[model samples]
Target: MTLALRLGKTLAELAGHQAPMTARELIFWMAFDQLSPISDRRSDVHAAQIATAVYQSQGAKVAFDDVLIDWSGEEEGVAEDDDALETLFAALSQS
Candidate 1:
């Protein structure tokens, strides 16, 4: 099975329900896995970059701050790393 499918199944099992997972959630999980050592500032930035691309591609408006919150369980409205957000947008624009 594809990575997404596998992830969906895993997420379903974790949730104890077979509810469908959205592309955004799958992409977020994939990126999070690839960008481990999340406590490291650099890895967090990279994961946010990838997740931003995935969400934007789907026409979703997700902020880096929100991504950080979701990934790290950080409080909402916490300040985001501006440099990381800029880098993410720059990379996405180039693609």
Candidate 2:
């Protein structure tokens, strides 16, 4: 069993024991756990680890190549989407 598979299972169990969560709600929990990006560089690192764990727990057969970068081009798109979502949520919460 890979790490992602393990995390997926954990996440499923957590969901089963609680209400369904939105991405924003999940991110908020991450913040509550002191895992948000602003507090520490490790936060981002931890976030990726958490994501991988969730994938594994879910029984996905993901590999490094499956999750890792193919090229720098992929990063740009991902960063843009992440930034947009983060900004939107940040703004909404502030007001």
Candidate 3:
């Protein structure tokens, strides 16, 4: 996968997190956050390798692409209007 793919995947994961993320997650996320507008530089490659290594240390024999790209086939949650509920009290707030 490309660096853009990596950054996007990492960002999506971070977005869904509601609780505190572990140091490993933070490290991994930050590593891929680089924009690298000039294409993959030497430092970026090193960062990618480090990110992959972090996963490998946890016993996952995954590649750089695997760690970076989202493997979940599930699509991002789309907001659907609940007309039935909206019709009701604007309904009970989940919060």
Candidate 4:
């Protein structure tokens, strides 16, 4: 698929997921994904992080796919190192 189209689709999927995204996860899927931004543009990483924090705090006030997800991600945020991220991505592939 074309890069922009693929990125758009990925963004849509990100919007549909129930979990609260950590900054690193958001940055990964937005900026470093195989489908990346055009050279003239960049993902709105800061704004996305702020928005995620808002959605997480609003909890019951927001719903995704008609389902209310109370995904409290206390210690479940994406890992900080490459090996852990590799493990996380491997686990995600099985989901």
Candidate 5:
């Protein structure tokens, strides 16, 4: 599946219902939270590998550098909203 489709499925699974947000939006939030300020090269590389698999599943081109650049840029204004994050986490925890 595409990254978007995979993320959407994950979001649906986590939420226990249809996600209210789009896959791109959810990925933006996750990239903002998870990809930015990545302190460990090992983990970063692992994430890139997973991203590549997802992209390839949908026959999409893998461009880790470009994706990382975009994700880094997205992190600028994407502050961690505790309330929203908490809600999402709560849903995930229940699943």
Candidate 6:
């Protein structure tokens, strides 16, 4: 499979676990996986750039921060960071 396919799959799996992740968390995940160190501050700009490239490759029109999303899909205003996800998950789990 292509890199885009791999990334999409990974993203889907991640999204499946919970709501959308923040750019910072996504960056961290990418860097942690050794894809690229888009996790740092200076690296953030580059990370966004790379994510945009990946997004385009996947034919996804939305950028990283457009909404709350998981592997299944997206919801408006959902963040992509652990804190935000945790809060959302907590609320969701209670329901």
Best by TM-score: 5
List, residue by residue over 1-95, the lDDT tens digit for candidate 5: 24434364555456576657677866766675564432465467677878878887999977776344343445655777899999999999999
Error of 2 at 3 (Å): 32
Give me the runs in candidate 5 sitting further than 4 Å from their true place. Answer: 1-39, 55-74
Candidate 6: where is the Cα deviation over 4 Å?
1-40, 64-95
Tell how far residue 94 is off in model 6, in angstroms.
19
lDDT of 2: 0.56
- Could you tell me which residue pairs clash in candidate 4? none
Q: lDDT per prediction?
A: 0.69, 0.56, 0.59, 0.54, 0.64, 0.59
**lDDT-better candidate, 4 vs 5:** 5
Cα lDDT tens digits for candidate 6, 1-95: 13434475445355566545568756656665564432244355556677788887989896765422233445567556898888999999999
lDDT (10s digit) by residue, model 2, range 1-95: 12323365434345565545568756665764563333345454566567777898999876534554344475543545787899999999999
Report residue 17 deviation for candidate 1 (angstroms): 60
Using TM-score as the measure, name the better of candidate 4 and candidate 6. 6
How high a TM-score does candidate 2 get?
0.26
Clashes of each: 0, 15, 0, 0, 0, 8
**How do the residues 1-95 of candidate 4 rate in per-residue lDDT, one tens digit apiece?**
24524565544345676555567656765556446554332334444555666786888454332232224544455556898889999999999
lDDT by residue (tens digit), candidate 3, 5-64: 556544335566545556876566466445533344545567778989998899988888
Give candidate 2 misplaced runs (Cα > 4 Å). Answer: 1-39, 63-95
lDDT of 1 by residue, 1-95 (tens): 23534454656656677677768777777687565533367666788888888998999998876575354556667677999999999999999
Q: How far out, in Å, is residue 51 in model 4?
A: 4.2
Q: Positional deviation of 41 in candidate 1, in angstroms?
A: 1.3
Give all TM-scores, in the order shown. Answer: 0.33, 0.26, 0.27, 0.24, 0.35, 0.27
Clashing pairs in 3: none
Q: Evaluate model 6: give its lDDT.
A: 0.59
Instruction: Output the number of the lDDT-best candidate.
Output: 1
Give the Å shift of residue 54 in candidate 1: 0.5
Error of 5 at 88 (Å): 0.5
